[model samples]
Target: MTKATSAARDDRPPLLALVGPTAVGKTAVSLRIAEALDAEIISGDSMQVYRRMDIGTAKLPLAEREGIPHHLIDILEPEEPFSVSMFQSLCAEKIREIHERGKLPFLVGGTGLYVESVCYGFEFQGDSGDEAFRERMRHFAQAHGAEALHARLAAVDPSTAARLHPNDERRIIRALEVFETTGRPLSETQAQTRAAPKTSPYRLCLIGLTMDRAALYRRINERVDAMIAQGLVEEVEALIRSGVPQDAVSMQGLGYKEIAAYLRGECSLAEAVERLKRDTRHFAKRQLSWFRHMQDLVWAEADEEGKIDDLFKSICAIIAGKFHLDLEYIR
Candidate 1:
C-alpha cells in the first residue's frame, strides 16, 4: 500500500470519510469520529441535502448533531435540483473554511458518487454526448448479454471496466459510451482525475463499516418497518396530495416510490413494504460494492452501542500517530 507521506500539504486538505449504506449506522458513528478528531462533518448524501425530505432520508435529527457543526444538510428544497458539480464546489469551500478554523473535516454519508467527487477531485463536466450513445449500448447489451459487452470494454479500457460487475450493464455500457463518444478511454479519464494533483487542503483516510450480509439485511428490514411505523405512507400521501410528481428525484427514493405504488393501487401495503425491504437491500448491496472497491479503507461493524466510539478511537489513534494531531482537542 502506497500511503501518503505528507501530513498537511498545500494541494489537498486532510479529510476523513465515513461511507456506508443506509440504515448501517453511519450517523452515530460519524458523530463519534467527529468528536474524536475535533472535526466538523460535511454530509455527502444527495437526498439529505433537501429540507422537507427528512423522514424518508433518515436524516440525523437536530439533537443528534449535538452542535458538532454539520454542513450541507437541509441546504435545498425538494423542488430544487442539486448536482455533483454543485456539491463539489460547495464542499471544497466548506473544507477550506473548516481547516482555517482549526478543525478537521469529516465527510460522512452513503452517497458514493458525491464522496468520489470530493476524494478524487472529479470534474463533473457535462457530457452532452452520452445519453443517445448510452441508449444504443444498452440495447446492444440487452440483445447480446451484459457479459459480452463488458468483455468488449475489458479489451479496450481494462481499468475502468474492471470496476464494473458483468451484471452492471448500465455503467459498463456508459463507460463504453463515454469512450465511443469522447474518443478517449474511460480509464484514461479516470486516471487523469486520479493523477490530477488534489486541490483540497486535508489529508484523508477512508473508513468502511460493514456486518454479516444476513445481519445487515435484518437491520434493513427493521429499519423499513420502522419507517412505515413512522408514517412513511402518510408522507408519500402528503407528497402526492401536494402535487409533487412521481418522477421527481425526491419521490424516487426507496420509501417514497414503493408507497406511491401502494397509493396507485398497484400493490397491497404489505407487498409495498416487502418490495421496499428488497429494494433497500439491493441498494445497500450496491453501496457495499462501491465501498469495497476503494483502494485503502478501514472497515468496522455496528454491533454494540459503543462500538462506533471504539472505532472512532481506533481511527483517532491512527490519525494522531500519523499526523501529530491531539485527540484531546477533538474530544
Candidate 2:
C-alpha cells in the first residue's frame, strides 16, 4: 500500500462519548468532560432533534451549557422524519470538524443506536427509499425469470444469493432492493452489523453512568413530577394545537405520548403522569440493556451516595485513564 493508503487504514480519529440511562446525571457530568478536553458536544439523542420538544426531551437550555458548543439538538421539525443513518452521517461530519479544529468530539446523549452507530460506524440501510427500485426489480423478475433475478442478485450479493432459492422471488428482490438503496451489498451490511461492537473506526472512550435500581427509579419518578411542574402538559398541548399529530414519531416519545394521551381524554392527568413515569423507567432499562451489549463501555456510578462531585470525578478518571490523559484536566 502507498503511504497515504497505509495511514488511512491504520489511523482513526479519537472520539469521546458519554452515555447513560435517562435522569442519570449525564448532562452535568458531560459538561465537565467537555471543558476538560476542550471538546464540542454532539447530542446522540433521537428526540432532541424536534423543535418544541424542550420539556419532554429535557433539552438543556443554551444558557446552562456553560458556553459549550452543542450540535444536533432542535434541528428538525416534529413532522420531519429522522433515522439512525441521518444521525450517523451528521455526527461523523461533526466529529471530523471538531478534529480539524484541534478539539475533541464529545458525543453525549442517551440514544443507544445513535451513539453506538457513530462509535462503530454502523452502515444503516435507512428507511425504504427504494420502492421504485423494488418495483423495477419485481418487473424485471416477472419479464425475465426468477432465475435471472437470482443471477443478478448473485452478481451483487452472492452470500445472500447463495442462501436464497431462485423461486424466492420476493426475497431476491428485497435483497437487491437493499443493495440498490444502501449502495452496498445486503450481505456486507448484515456482516458489518454483526461485527459492529467488535469493530470501530475511531479511538473511542465511551463512558456510561448508572446508579442503584431503586434510586434510579426514584429519580425517574421525581423527574416526571418535575416535568409536570415545569408544564410538560402545556408543552404537549401547544404542540397539538400547533398541528403536531398525536401519533407523530416525535409525539410518541415518553412524556409527549403519555401527556398527549391525557389531552385526548384517553386518561386523566394523574394517570398520564403515572404512565409517563412507568414508561420512562422502562425506557431507562432498555437504554442500559443496549449499552451493556456494546463492547468496551467504561461504567461509572452516577450516584456515589448522591454526591455529584464524587461521581463526576470518578467519570473523569475513567476517561482520562482510557485515553491516557491527566485526570485533572477539569476546569
Candidate 3:
C-alpha cells in the first residue's frame, strides 16, 4: 500500500462530524463550520456521492460550497454500488490528507451508517460475489419470500439478523449469501476485523444539528416545493431518460424515489409530494435517533429564522471545549 493509504488507515486526527436529518440545513451550517475551523469538508452522505444525482440528492453546487474544499461528493455514478466500506476507506484517506495539510477534517452530512462506520472503525468483509451465488440467493428470496430468506439468515447468522430490519430482506439475504459462500458468518468476520475504538488516528468531535420537529418538517416541506419549482420533476425525467435504474441506490434517495414513482404512474404527482414530505420527516426522526445513540456528539439547534451562523457558533464552542482547540486560530 502507498504511504497515503497506510496513513489514512491508521491516523485519526481532530475531526468534526456535522450530522443531522435531511433538509435540516446541515449544508449551510457545515459551510460555516468549515470556514470557521479552516477545515476541509468530507461528505458523510451516501447519496451525495453520485454524479448527475444533484437535484434529487440535494447535493451542494460548487458555488454553494463557498470555496470550502469538499471531499467524497459526486465521485460515483448513480448506477455503481458504493458501500460504506468504500466510504470509510476513501474518507480515511481524505482525513489523513487534510490532517497532513495542517487543517482539520470536518465530516458533514446526514448519512449515519457512513459516519458510524468510520467513527467506530467498523469492518466490512469483502463482497466478492460470484454470479452463481448471487443468483442462488436471489432465487431463494423469490421462491420463499424475503421473510423466509431472513429466517434462513437468522438460523445461520443471528447477530446480523438482530441488527437488520426484517423488511431489509435485501441485506438479510445478502448477509446469508456471504456466509454461505465464504463458509463464515458475516457478523463474525466483521467482529474479527474490528479495529480498536479511539484507536482511530483522529480526535473526533461530533456535532449534531437539530430543530423542533414541526419547524424541521416545515422546512422539509418548503424545500420540496422549492425543488419542484427548481425543476426536480424535470431532473428526474432526465435521469429516467438516461436509463438510470429505478432500483439504483441514487434513485432510492428520498426525493428521487417519490418522484420516480410519479414518473412511473405508481402515484399522482400531488401524492408523491405529500409522501416526500412525510418520508423526509420520518427520515429526520430516524437521523435524530441515530445521532442520539452515538457517543460524544454536541448538539446545536437551528435559530428561529434558521440563520446558520448561530448554530455554527454553538458548534465551534462545543468543539473548542472538547478538543481544547483555539477558536481564534481556527477562525
Candidate 4:
C-alpha cells in the first residue's frame, strides 16, 4: 500500500471504550476484555494521571494490571494540571501507537468528558487567559464560596453548571472566563465546535456497565471502607507533606479532598470517611446520568450476585458482532 493508503488505514482502527461510574468493576472487566483481544489499556481517568494518588484514585497497581500495557497513568505530578484537550491529544497518540503494534486500544475509565471528547473529536477552542479577570473571579469565589461561584456560572450557562460540581472551581473559573472573552456561553461555543462536520477517525465501540442502584451504592460504600483500610489517609498526608496544595485540582478529587479535610482537623476521620462515601455515591449518579445521554452505547448490566464473567461474555459478544472478530481467539 502507498503512504496515503496506509495513513487512511491508520485512522480507522477499531477503538473500544469501556466507561461507567466508579467502583462498578470496570477495571476487572476491562482487563478480561483486553487480555482476550490482546489489546492495550489507555486510562480515561483524570485523577489516575497524577503520581502519588494511588489509594484515593483506586489506581490499579502493576500487579493488578496482570502484565497488560496501560498508558496515561502516573504521567504527571500532583500539582500539574490536566485538561480534556491534553487527554485527547495524548490518548490519540497512544491509540495510533497501539494500532501500529497490531493491538487494539481500549479506553477504560468513568470520566465522561474525556471519553466523549475523544469519541466525538472535540476541537477545543483555546481560551486567552486574562490574569486580571481571573484574579477578580478568584477573589469573588474566595469572598463568597465555591457554591456562589458555581451559581454565577449557572446563571450564564446552566448546562455547564449542571455538569460540573461546585467544588470544581478551576473549571468554573475557566467557563466564566470563556464567556467574558467570547461573549458566548461556554456551552454555546462547545455546541458550535461539535457541530462542525468532522468525521471521527476511528471505528468506535462504546461499552457501558451498570448495575442495580442499591447494589452499586453498597459497592461504592464498601470500596471507600477498603480504601481507608488501605491507608488512604496516609497517602493524602504524604502528598500534603510533599507540598501538594489543599486547593490544587488533584486534592479536589473524590477521596483526596475528604481525607485532606480530616488531616487538617476540620473533620473527624469517621465523618470524613462517611462524607467520602456519600459524595462518591452522588458522583456515580451523575456519571450514570451523563452516560444515559450518550447515544449508541451497548450497556451491560452486572448481576446483583456480582457475576462479572457473565458481563464480560455479553461485552465480548457485542464486540465480536460489531467488529466481525472471532470469539474463539478471546476464549
Candidate 5:
C-alpha cells in the first residue's frame, strides 16, 4: 500500500462528525450513532455551551442524551465570552480523552466554523486580543450602526461578510480587524489555512443530514414555537434578572435577543416571536451555505418520518467502508 494509504489506516481513533442545518435532526441522529458506537459526544455548537441558554439553542437535556457522556454543554455562564479557538482547544482535548478510553468521539452540531476548525485542524495564528482596536470597532459600530460596520467588512472581505449577519457586529469587526492587521482578507487567509497540506489531523468521517428546504423551514418554525411554549421568555428573564447584560455575547443569540426586546418594551411579544422565527430560518440557510463548502462529507436524507434507523444504517455502512471499522459491535 502507498504510504498515504497506510497512514490513513493508522491506529489513531477515527472521529465521526454529524453536521447540518438547524432542526435537521442532528441531535437525535448523533445520540443514536454515539450509542451504537459506544462513543462520547463533543458539541460543535457555539450557543449550546452556555449554562442557561438551553431551549433556544435546542440543546439536548441530560435526560435526552440517553446517558451518553457529552462535552462542552452548560460549561459557561451566559455573560462569559467564547470563541472558536476555545472550542477547538477544548474539543481536541476531549477527543484525545475519548480515544484513550477506547471510545469513539462524535463531533456533533450545526455550528459550521466550530466543526470545520476541528475537522481541518485550523491554526489560530492571530493574536487573541487587540483591546484598543476592538474598542475602536465597538465605538464605530455604536456610532455608525452595525450595518455600516458590516458594509466596511464587505468592502474588504465580501466572503466573510456574506457568511455573517449584519447585526453580528462582533464577528464583522473581527474580520475587518484581521484584514487591517494582516493586510489580507480574512476569507483569503482562512482559505490558505484550509488549503495547507497538514490540515486534517484525525481520521474523519463527516456525515451531513439534509432534506427538503421547505421541510427544514417548517421544523425550524415549529422549534421556535416549542421554545416559546417551553418558557423561553421566562428563561431569558431569569438570565436578565441574574444580571446578564442585554448586549452580552450570549444574549445576542436568536431567541434571547428577540425576547429581550419584548421584555424591554421595544417590541410586542408577537412581533418578537415572529422575528425570532424569521431570523432562525435565515440562520439555517446560512448554515447550509457554509456546509456546502466543506469537503468529503457523506450526505443522508432525513425523511419526514424522522426515523433514525435507516440513517443509522447508512452512516454505519459509510464508517465501515471509509474507516475500516468493525460494525459487529454496533448491533
Candidate 6:
C-alpha cells in the first residue's frame, strides 16, 4: 500500500483509473497495479457489464484476476438497457463500498466516457435515450463505416463531434440523436450543465496508455485473431441463441457485433474477422483521440515487447506522485 498521504484531512474518495484503447493490455497492467495497491477493480468497460458475453468482451476469467474483486461486470442481462447515468450511479456506490473495506477503487477499461463520467462526476439529462435511433446509427456505421457516422454527427453537432473520436460511433450517434430529438446540440446542452455546480467529487488519478500507431494496429489485429481462436464466434452464437436481440446494446460491442453478423449469415467468418480487425484498429485510434482530449490524464507509453517493466515503474511513479503516496511497484 502507498504511504504518506494526508488521508485524514481529505474526505473525497480516491479513484485510480487506467484508460486506453482496446488491445493495449490495460487489463494485464491493471492486475499488477491493483494487487500492489490493495485495490478492488471496478470495470469501467461499457460492454463487460452484460452476462454470458465474455470472450467477445475480453473479460479476463475470474481465476485470472488474481483474487481482485471486480464490480460492474456481468451484472446486467443483455436485454436490460444500460445508460451513462446508471453506470455513474452504480460506480459511485461501488467506490464507496470499496473505500469502506479500506481498499483503493481501481477503474479499469477502454471505454472513455464511462471512465470520464466517474472521474468528473458528470451529470446527465433525464432522457434514457432512443434505442431505435442508436440501433439505426449502429447499422449505419456497420454498413458505411465509423467515419461516415462521425461525419454525420459533425454535420449536426460539430463541436461535440470535433472532440469525440470518429470511431466513437456510439457517442457520435448520441450527439446526433440529441440534435434530432430536441433540436438542440448536445454540446450546447452540456455547456448549460457546466454552468451548474457540477464538479468532480473524487480525488482522481488517471493514467492513459498509448503506443505507436503501427505497433498498436498490429496488436489489435493479433487480439482479434486471439479472440477468434478463443471461441468469440461461439460466444456470440450462444448469446444470439439465448434470445439476446441482435440489435441489443450489448450485441453492438466491438467483437460481438462483427461475430454476430457472421452468426446471422450476413457475412462469411473470414470477412467478419477482417472487418473486426479493421474496425478495432479504428476503435483504438478513436480511443487515443478521446484520451488526448481528456484533461488530467497522465500519459504512459506501453510497449508489450520491450521496456515493459520501465513502463510499469513509470506508471507507478505517476500514481504515487499524483496521490502523494509511496508505491511499492510490486505485486
19-72 per-residue lDDT for model 3 (tens digits): 888877888878877777778999999888999878777878998889999999
Order of candidates by lDDT, top first?
4, 5, 6, 2, 3, 1
Tell me the TM-score of each prediction against the true structure: 0.76, 0.77, 0.82, 0.91, 0.92, 0.84
Candidate 2: residue 90 Cα off by (Å): 0.7
Report, for every candidate in turn, its global Cα lDDT versus the true structure.
0.77, 0.83, 0.79, 0.87, 0.86, 0.84
lDDT of 2 by residue, 1-331 (tens): 0011112233678899889999988888788778767889999899999998999999999999999999999999998877788999999999999999988889999998789889988765556667888889878988998799999999999988976546556568878888876789987876667555467788898888888888999999998999999999999999999998664668767798788879989899999999888878877987897788777898998873456788777876776666666544445
| Candidate 2: stretches off by over 4 Å | 1-10, 129-197, 304-306, 328-331
Residue 209, model 3: Cα distance from true site in angstroms:
1.0
Candidate 5 wrongly placed segments (more than 4 Å): 1-9, 195-199, 326-328
User: After superposition, which runs of candidate 1 have C-alpha atoms over 4 Å from their true positions?
Assistant: 1-11, 127-201, 304-306, 326-330
After best superposition, candidate 3 residue 5: deviation in angstroms?
30
Q: Write the per-residue lDDT of candidate 6 for residues 2-64, one digit (tens) a residue.
A: 675664576688899999998887888888888888899999999899999888888999999
Tell me the tens digit of each residue's lDDT in model 1 across 111-196. 88788788767767774556877787777877998689889899888977766656556557767877787878887886666555
Better of 1 and 4 by lDDT: 4
**Every candidate's CA RMSD:** 6.2, 9.9, 5.8, 3.9, 3.4, 4.3
For model 6, give the 10-residue run with minimal summed lDDT: 191-200
lDDT of 4 by residue, 1-331 (tens): 0011112333467889999999888998899888888889999999999999999999999988999999999999999888888999999999999999988899999998899888777778664588798999999999999999999999999988987778788889999998998889998986666546555667888999999899999999999999999999999999999998888988999999888889989899999999999999999998998788665678999776666788988998888766766666565
Q: Rank the models by TM-score, top first.
A: 5, 4, 6, 3, 2, 1
TM-score of structure candidate 6: 0.84
For candidate 4, the 10 contiguous residues with the lowest summed lDDT are 1-10
